[model samples]
Target chain A: MDIATVNALTYEDFVNVLGNVVEKCPLIAAAVWSGRPFLTLTALEAAIREFIDALPESGKEGVLRCHPDLAGRDLQSGTLTRESREEQAGAGMDALNSADASRMARLNQEYKERFGFPFVICARMNDKANILRQLSERCQNERAVERARGIEEVKKICRLRLEALVLTDAANKL
Target chain B: MDIATVNALTYEDFVNVLGNVVEKCPLIAAAVWSGRPFLTLTALEAAIREFIDALPESGKEGVLRCHPDLAGRDLQSGTLTRESREEQAGAGMDALNSADASRMARLNQEYKERFGFPFVICARMNDKANILRQLSERCQNERAVERARGIEEVKKICRLRLEALVLTDAANKL
Candidate 1:
């Protein structure tokens, strides 16, 4: 869909397509829908990013919590929203051997214990090796840094989702 | 799936299948899973109801908030969880005429404005007339009454999901 098509969307159509762009936080899309007729797909994403950044710290944590843990129970259960399952599978999460799966679970748990939110990365941008390494390394960061890190990763994921949903000029990858 | 099969599922698989039985509040299933080896499908539901009943008022309200409106945006956007889509359709929610759809949307907005949560009914159990009537009548309810009323509907929905998942003897409808 082009920016014109995107700008033409009714609130309901826009939310349905981009609601999960931020991973179960359609409220973001709902909140940003009022900022329609975006000059470019970039502006639409910027609006979403602003909405997320404006949330209180607890609200930010809540947003992160909305995300399923990578390779976690939702994946095992076939309960992942279609977008998440595809992203995780793209990163080879679905093919983890037992030992690696157990390791990922442990790291996810420990990270959540320390930071009170899941360790989020743009699964489409990182393969199995990078995701595991980041989880291990980021465990040592202060809560403040980890929180920002998670939010930034959320933006990365958000951009990829937007690009997939909205067409842009060659110079501006939506 | 039978009672024996339910009892045999590992925690992950159990949660995956039943996680959404309570709409988006998988935490309820996660909480109830501690009481394993349910002797009958009834026992499993009883365990779930007990857990829900134990939640404080705010938690109960949160559970209600997790529900999509009866014929609201998620339906328009195709974002309703599969279970919800089916439930609403089962009750003819998807077949609303323009007049009724607008009325339902107006009632939904009014209900939320007044009560801070969507007007909820077990769609599988109530067709359009009954659902609309209940919404109108229930709008006049005290918050406490509506709260309890909402929880009861959730339980009804829960029971249907449970029965659909777990087969039982003729004497015990799961």
Candidate 2:
């Protein structure tokens, strides 16, 4: 909606309105709720970003871990969020053949073994080949480095979600 | 440094050895080559991670465009090898901030003008508050989806560059 409308929203109302932007990380939106009366969407986005950035490393890891793998269990079991499902499909992840899927599974296992978390990437920005390439390449990184990379990917997913919510809300006059 | 001797190479030789795991992505070595052989490291790390599933999107307009604002110039400053710089830094983009970076730059400008890129999340992973959060967030996207998500983040960067000479040379070794 308009800046004035968002700026005036009640904390509960605000959370209900835009909190799913970060997948399971609702606290990010909740934490920034009181910072409302935002002069612009930019100001509001900044507030939310600050809250996430200020979180402890454990918190960040929690956020990264919250994301589903590119083509793992979530896809097979139909547990991925609609946004995630669509993003993965857009990246051509849904098109993997059995052999490629098997390879992907192997890489996924190897990656988790190496990095201690599921492999996460903004699938919306990738093709299946590139995603697999990254899965292989990043598995070789140090844990700390991979953790940072994972969080960074989380940030991208969140940003896209935020844009969709805010603009659609604004356009619809929600 | 043949594959047979790779198991016995000194740390220095190991870096000199399979260093080019990916064709063009050479910095993987400069960054972590010192870790060496890895025969024992993996065993130790696995013992430590019997712990941690993990943890855990955005506004419109401003959010999509947020990340393009970071100091991506560091990408072109030659401070980051095309590969190493892309991952630790963000989306594999160096020319993102440059107006003349490519046709992608043009689209990025048009995107901002139309729906444009949004500014949603903070770019840093763990906990630093930079207004460039969205900029960094977009950078986190895989080079592919990011290409469609915006020019600023392309997943293509993650693929092996496949230098014909190197592959042929390696094939000969095989």
Candidate 3:
């Protein structure tokens, strides 16, 4: 849909379409609806990023916590939200060999223990090998730095989601 | 917390505290935060209901779809969000017999098949037996009727959650 179509949407329709753009945090989309008549897809995205960036540390962690663990149980039981399923599959998370899956599980557990939230990267932007390496490397970053890094990744995921749903090229101009 | 304390929370704090009041649908809490400085707990809950009741049929379904299945894998694996885990346990869902657990699984699957959303009842307001009975009976409801019933159950769940988090007796005045 065009930016006008997106801007014209009622709150419910806007939320229904863009709600899951930020993992399980439909709250962001719901909050952003009040800022409608977004001049372009980039403005819409900036609104989303601003909301996330303005949250307190605890709220930011809550947003990260809403994400499912990479290659975790929800993926196994076929119960992941559609966006997550597609994104995970795109990065070969759905096809991990037994060894890779087990290693992923171990790393994920350790990551959560340290960070109090899931290790989030934009899966569509990276493949499995790179994801594993990043997961391993990021696990050692200072907690505050890692939290900021995770939020940045969330923005990347959000931009891609917005591109797919609304106008594609507008965000690039920003 | 008292009404003043509840009302005084910043949007981030308000959402952090009450975000899961409607199961996984934090969008309701996020949207409700805009209406803050509530006069009383009753008004706070009314705001939540207003946001929900205003949703179109599909949005209502989207709210219901956010619920985890009763005694489903989330419970078995101990991965339920804190609010859901406590609510389910308060009704003794944590201790279902093997036979009952299997029956619940089957019924939940069938209910989803019929309604396109999980069977939802206020588990804190009903024991496992009543939940099962309601699930079985509601499974036969016309799709539209069942959807409404599920939303009412969500409201009941929301109220109980609000009572636990904010003032308790003020909502009874409504």
Query: How accurate locally is residue A166 in candidate 2, as Cα lDDT from 0 to 100?
Result: 69
Fnat: each model in turn = 0.00, 0.00, 0.06
**Local accuracy of candidate 2 as per-residue lDDT tens digits, A55-103:** 4454455455556677777788898878888888899777889998999
Model 2, C-alpha of A132: deviation from truth (Å): 1.2
TM-score winner, 1 or 2:
1
Every model's DockQ: 0.06, 0.02, 0.07
Misplaced by over 4 Å in model 3 are A168-174, B1-19, B22-159, B162-174
What ranges in model 2 sit over 4 Å off?
A170-174, B1-174
Q: Stretches of candidate 1 above 4 Å error?
A: A168-174, B1-174
For residue A145, give model 3's deviation from the true position in Å.
0.9
Per-residue alpha-carbon lDDT of candidate 3 for residues A54-145, written as tens digits (9 for 90 to 100): 66565566567667778997899998988889999999999999999999999998887787667999999999999999999999999899
Chain A TM-scores in order: 0.94, 0.88, 0.95
lDDT of 1 by residue, A85-168 (tens): 999999999999998899999999899778766899999999999999999999999999998899999999999988977753
